[model samples]
Target: MNKFLLTFKDSKIEKDYQENKLNTLQKPIFYWLLVMSFTLNLLKVILDYTYYTVNNQSWMNVGFVILVILELFLACYKKQYIKYALIISNLSAGLLQINFDESNTFPQEYYSYGSYYAMLSVVVYFMTDFPYSVFQVFIHLSMKIFFTTIKSHRIDMLGIILGLITNVFLVLTLYICDWNSRRQFLLNLREVRWEESLPFIIKKPFYLFTYKDKNMSFQVNRAYNQDFFPYYNQEDCCGCNFRQFLRKCKVENNNLEIYLFDKRNEKLDFDLVYQNKTHKFDIRVCAIGLDQINYLIILEKLKLLTTSYIPKQTNLRQKIFQIKKTQIKYQHQKHFLLGVFSMFLYNNKEITSINLVDVLQKFSSRYFIISKSKIHIVYSDRSIYQLITYKHQLIIYLIQLFDCLINNQADPHSGIKLLLNQGLYAIRLKIYLTNRLKFQEQYKDNFFIQEIERNILSEEIDERLEISFLKKVRSAETSI
Candidate 1:
């Protein structure tokens, strides 16, 4: 036998050998079936009483009603004892209804009703997990069969066959369903255990602290990408315990940061800290510089490296970098911003390129006229350029450049326009610098520059850019 099977057997042995007796009440279904059985028995009692009343057996009618009232009281008050009460009530009522007198008896056909009652008892037994009630079902069935065979004088072959077949089928069906349910439950338990062990293998790098104003209606939201944080496989990850990993995370000022290393020699920094009265986390740094597509390629290569059957190689870094380059090239061709313009056209959608260009031109004209400075809008779909000039002499040529350059077909000048407009907006708004020439005299009387200075720092700019791209990707995925 397999070692795993031996472990399961050991567990079973421990469960069986243990003398501790915990409460084993029937589940909700058992209660429901019991109530239904009671209702059926009550109807049978009413029918029996009517028959006896018409035949002048008034004494039997009173006794039957008293027994039913007692059964109902026990069902309500002594709920745990209801199962035994039901069995006694059903058997007593069944016997009274038959009124089997040797001097005067009913037809053999009337006795077949006992088989239906027996089958119902079997159903209730199967629904319940209570060991005592389960044994009672077998005893009840045996008694019913004995009485039924004796009452009919000759054994009713049809009744005997039906009873045996139903018992076999009922038992088999219940056993299979129970076994399958157990197997699924065990599988789910294993999956949960694996999930709990994930954090150890991933070895998070940094914690991000966030806070939200209590007066504000909105709250801060943070998310992590699964591509960078790959699912941890149980076999390898199980060796690194989660509790130990958390201890080593080195918490400082109620903040914890951990560094994770992948098979490609790539490093990821994760930070965990309290924010908005709740724990917030962030991936502070990633050694893998590529975007989503490139990240996936590295992950695949790492899988091969980590697997036991694969031979380890010292040239892994070179192989990973090659894969990253291929992925970058593929993404540049497929998901480039310029490619979006073609996608819109191919889908028979109106291009927003012209609308964007018109908006920039109008903004530039208004700003130039108001300030008496030539605000040149030079932009492209990817880059934003602006020439901020006071009295024909260029003060500053703000170039809001894109990190990634791609070929765009629509409005061949879109990239140039994007760069120009972004620059114009930055300068007009005086986003970063406190003493920019355009905003120096006019904004000196205002507190906007002071506020902007506080808000638009270099770190804030990088965060905003990253957040903007993340939002765009998420929104695009939803639209698709």
Candidate 2:
């Protein structure tokens, strides 16, 4: 009981929990209370009418009947205005029963309408919060005292004592109900927060939940759960035991990378292997700081070298050709940028001996279509030109060759300009950049892609594309 009362001492937590409980239970409570109010008040009106008719009495019975009828209508018809309905129904019922009692008697409990106030007190406590229920109890108690004094033409000690006992019971019951509601709310708080934060939970594969402490070496008491690990309850620990790992690795911060060579049974003592012929992984660790000592660690496994599994039936030519075809096909499938560049001799009126197929095969190793104006290249998964040094240099050479054609009175339509225009180049760049940004953002979890992105790009391509595309357009316009 003392513990329960202590909960109310922290008014903020109590109020917060109370409001949460009310929000969760309000709809069901609303319906239940409405039904009870309608049934009870309807009975009250009927009883009052029958009594009045039998006795051939008037004022007090008529008033009680009218008030009960109002309560019934409020409960039935004015349901949407529930707060007002609850207040009016509870208040009106208690007041009418007290003021308009049939017996002109001291101590209203002995009268016909005595039990009505006590019943209404129960309803008030259940359907509303403590303060409001307490308010109603006080009002009912005060009215009972006032009425008893007036009826006896003196202060009735017995009636006052009974009212005080009833109010005490009501108050205690209200507190207990509220305390239970708060306890239930606290029990479901974690689940409620988790449900509300689905987006955060879905993205975070490994969640490190810990409690911060003042006495410990680390500010947090590390509570490890295996559920977040990829292979939960498996033989491979995957370095999940952070407490042990921290001691062995001599870690300063949350970021720690340790490579373990799994040799099926035996442990390697040297930790060094020649010619990259070992089962080794470059593990990258990135920690996201959540609190003082509580953090989320993202572990990435990268295989530097591995033995290739080859088919026994397939020869070297078949394997080489298959790999080449797969690379080209993948490039074609994920093509994000397409550029057209044509080549022609400086003094030639027309292409007499320039075989398009030969040029594409000899100069650019990538598959391309030879149009009348230029050789078209599609940058699918990446800039294939950037991968081959000669290919990049060859493109520059071809552009220069075409420029020489312009100087040598060659056809105006036979160059890079004929293949692509300024506006078209800008639009294509935008489309390419947008698609590439979207693609990178999609598969950024892959280790190889992250490595490539980190090494090859100065700034984030997506950021550059979005931020500097306009500047590129301006430069393109100026060049044009």
Candidate 3:
């Protein structure tokens, strides 16, 4: 008998589905429901005082006050325990109301006045998983029916049927809604994961599309910013979309041959000044293709390219020599093309942004040079690259410390543009590490190498990777 019971319990459908459903529900949504339930119940009890006799008045008031206090405590101190706590408390209050209704000689409409809290409970817990919600409502209804029939020594078949119909209808409706919501949540989660992984595959924030015919439509249109170039005025552009703009441009520019046939197996860079009679803006277009149909499109604003900050040089020859000297001595950088990105194979290991204050604090305790050195890190999308050169004195030990702030690039120009707009002069370098496979494949079997990669690139940069990179520099200085 015990084995049969255990098997029955284990066979329950959608077990722990509430756990996933709760994860999708925002904390604000949880709090809003809690507040609404309490406020409505309090108002219901006060306004419908005729339902409660003088004998039961104190008990009902005391029970409600206690429930509210418990809810408030759960909201503040015991949030994790809310799912179980709330279900038990609500079920208890509902049973108490039914027990009181049994003593009355008059017709007891518990479903309308006393046990309507059960319906409210169902609505509140609907945000949880469906099965758990149905189970709670079933328990509440069963207790009400059992207690009422047992006390009165009679059963109302019509009343029982009505109660079942109302509560069961609510349960089924809520379950369907919850199921639909959970499905949509999962889809959105998958979409976000795809967006994050796309950059690792493409390297550049350029769009790729396939054209099977002279119509030249997109098979895959994934760009970092969907609004890279505006085709319509915000006020008058009610139905303007990227696809519509591309089709209109094909007709206006009459460049179907240039877009499809001429740019095959080659890269084409040109300036396109698009004018719609009312407005005009210059766009720099870069196109690269593998065959006639498949191609990559890179678009940038002409104003951005022309008005970009260019460092003033006293001597062009001397500056070039200095830059070369710095690159050979300090940079030793590896450039990765967006062309080589593969979802399974490619990984970027470059660290980009670092806090100036934190870097200074860590450096103060370290034993290293305070001499001026040129530190360059480049971050680019497709057309323009942001080059950040730090001329400040940097300690050697603090090299890998910046890895903690290195995030994979998503936007084409925002990070560098923000830095430029803010008038920041000393710090600028955007880097993407395109060789994470080195940490996985090259050193997968080597525990020592794996440790070195994790230490250098993880949340806190491992001191060992920084020391290893600078080992040659230290050795050369000692030899001299």
**Model 1, 1-480: lDDT tens per residue?**
122221124565324322111123333433565456456556656665665434434455456556666766776676565556655654554454444443444556345654566666655554343344435545655665787777667777787778678766765666555455445545655544543553444443221112223532111122122222222112223213222323333344321213232222344433333211111122233233332111111111111111232123434345334444664543323322332222222212121212333544654554334333333444345223322111100101110111111121123233222232232113221122212343333333322222222111111122112101010111101110
Give per-residue lDDT, candidate 2, residue 253.
Answer: 35
Rank list by lDDT: 3, 2, 1
Q: Candidate 3: deviation at residue 110, Å? A: 5.4
The TM-score that candidate 3 achieves is 0.39
- Which sections of candidate 1 miss by over 4 Å? 1-25, 37-52, 55-119, 129-137, 157-162, 205-480
Candidate 3 stretches with Cα past 4 Å from truth are: 1-53, 99-111, 114-118, 158-175, 206-480
Q: Quote the positional error of residue 471 for candidate 3 in Å.
A: 28
For model 2, what is the alpha-carbon lDDT of residue 230? 23
Candidate 1's displacement at residue 451, Å, is 13
Tell me the tens digit of each residue's lDDT in model 3 across 263-359.
Answer: 5546656666654322233444455433333444544331212112222333433533443455432221111111111111112223343443344
- Cα RMSD, each candidate: 21.3, 17.2, 20.1
Weakest 10 consecutive residues, lDDT, candidate 1? 467-476
Estimated TM-score for each candidate: 0.33, 0.36, 0.39
List residue ranges in candidate 2 displaced over 4 A.
1-32, 39-53, 56-81, 96-117, 151-154, 176-191, 194-203, 206-480
The best candidate in terms of TM-score:
3
